[model samples]
Target: MKTKLSLFFIAIISYSCSVNQNKTKQSDLPIIGTWELISATTKEKDSTFSTFNPKLKMIKIINPTHFSFFQHDLTMGKGPNPTFAAGAGKYTLVNDTYTEYLEYFIHREWENNKFEFKISIQNDTLTQQGVEKVEKLGVDRIITERYKRVKN
Candidate 1:
């Protein structure tokens, strides 16, 4: 009887530990899902705000350790000024601060750059804003982007 009791207790402890471990891993990821970009704005060095393209559509997919984004014109690439952009990289999120290490991009000059942004989540919306300064690329601006979570 004692041996059976011991085995049962051991099984209970093992199950409890596994459940707690799963919860901890899930809690660590607050931004694991698909998000669609709704709007964006860029503030140049002169403190002028430039609205992003209203007709363009973009989506950013984030997993446990990596993120990727794809953007293009809504005209199915048939517009007079067709556009498409995509990039993917690993990222880290510590509380409200998120940092992305750009690993792959069509624009080679923008690769291997670290971009950090402050992020916030409200309801189903996520907003991130930070400075984007790459001297070699001649890009210096503060960009703010708002995204809505894409529900599956």
Candidate 2:
């Protein structure tokens, strides 16, 4: 009888521990949905910043282990060439950090690129700030974006 009780308590403890670990992993980023870009800012060479035109529409979709985003100058409908830029790949979320490996991209230059960002979501909005070095024209550029969750 004592041995059975001991086994029962051990099983309960193990189950409890597994449940807590799963919760921790899930809480890393509760970011699994489509989001519309509110703004995208880039730090310029001279330490200045430039934001994309508000008229440009960008959308991001996150799934269990894959993600994709696309930008369009036209806000609606399919065009002969609507995508300004688009990419899709597998992604991993750890703690507050999100990383994506570019498996496919409209622009060939970005193919196989890796993107690391500090991700945070609050009040129906999501923010992603670049945590990796991105250079252009011999100047370091940083990307910051704010997105609003699209409710279906």
Candidate 3:
């Protein structure tokens, strides 16, 4: 009788632990969704300027392990200022910090680089800001971007 009681208690404790381990916290989940860019700005040295044109549309999709972004002109790349840009790669999120690996890009020189940013989401809006610096490309600037979540 004593042996059976001890085994039963052990099994109950193990089951409880497994159940708790399967649950994920809510804060760890808000970043996984489709988002549309509302505005973007870049600051370099003494100059700050807007990088997002009102005529262009940009969307970014972030999953549990990866993220991708694409932007194009509203005129279907046929207007006076045709533009298209896209990049994608894996990412890691720790608290409010997000890091992305640029694995795919039209400009090959920008690939294989790691970019880290601080992100914050309030209601349906998200803001990301960080420094993007590439010595080979002579690029060093701070970029701030705002996005709204896409609803189904």
Number of the top lDDT candidate = 3
- Cα lDDT, model 2, residue 149: 96
Arranged by TM-score, best first = 3, 1, 2
lDDT of residue 37 for candidate 1: 88
Model 2: runs farther than 4 Å from truth? 1-26, 75-83, 131-139
lDDT of 2 by residue, 80-136 (tens): 654487889998888888888989888666667677888899989999998434344
Error of 2 at 105 (Å): 1.0
Q: List lDDT for all candidates, in order.
A: 0.88, 0.80, 0.92
Cα misplacement distance, residue 113 of candidate 3 (Å): 0.6
lDDT of 1: 0.88
Candidate 2 to truth, TM: 0.72
Q: Kindly indicate the candidate among 1 and 2 with the higher TM-score.
A: 1
Considering every candidate listed, which one attains the maximal TM-score?
3
TM-score of each: 0.79, 0.72, 0.81
Residue by residue across 1-152, what tens digits does model 1's lDDT show? 99999999999999999989776232243688899988888989667665667798889999988999999999999989999999999988877888899999989899999999999898899999998888997898989999999998
Sort the predicted structures by lDDT, highest score first: 3, 1, 2
